[model samples]
Target: MPIINLNGPKLSTAKKKELVKRFTEVASEVIELPEEAIIVEINEMPPENVGVGGELLSEKEDK
Candidate 1:
């Protein structure tokens, strides 16, 4: 089974729906395995959970 893990900012409902559709379509073309064997997981986190350089995204210094 193929598992795809996606991590990024929280996505809108529409974007989530789109991702599900697109992921299935794209994975089918690239992986020769059975369509049912593919698994896609999307993990969304708040800006506070992300970091850049030495600081959390929510604590980054102003540009």
Candidate 2:
């Protein structure tokens, strides 16, 4: 069994499952692990959780 932790921006529920499926499919080929045995954890973060160019990734500018 493989445990994969994925972190990224907010995603829809369907998209989340799609990501898991895709990850599982691609990883299973190389790791020799069953798709069912793979565990994927998606950690969706709000814009504020990320930053860029010395600024928070909010909807508005930091300055």
* lDDT per model vs. reference: 0.80, 0.85
RMSD of each: 2.1, 2.4
Q: What are the runs in model 1 whose C-alpha is more than 4 Å off? A: 61-63
In candidate 2, how many Å is residue 4 off?
Answer: 1.2
What tens digits encode model 1's per-residue C-alpha lDDT throughout 1-63?
A: 678788988899999888877887788778866668777889997778888787787776344
lDDT of 2 at 31: 95
Tell me how far the alpha carbon of residue 39 in candidate 1 is from the true structure, in angstroms, after superposition. 1.3
Q: Pick by TM-score: which candidate is best?
A: 2
Per residue, candidate 2 scores C-alpha lDDT tens digits across 1-63 of: 689998788899999989998999988988987888899999988879777777677845454
Model 2 lDDT at residue 46:
83
Minimum summed lDDT over a 10-residue window in model 2 is located at 54-63
**Candidate 2, 41: how far from true, in Å?**
0.4
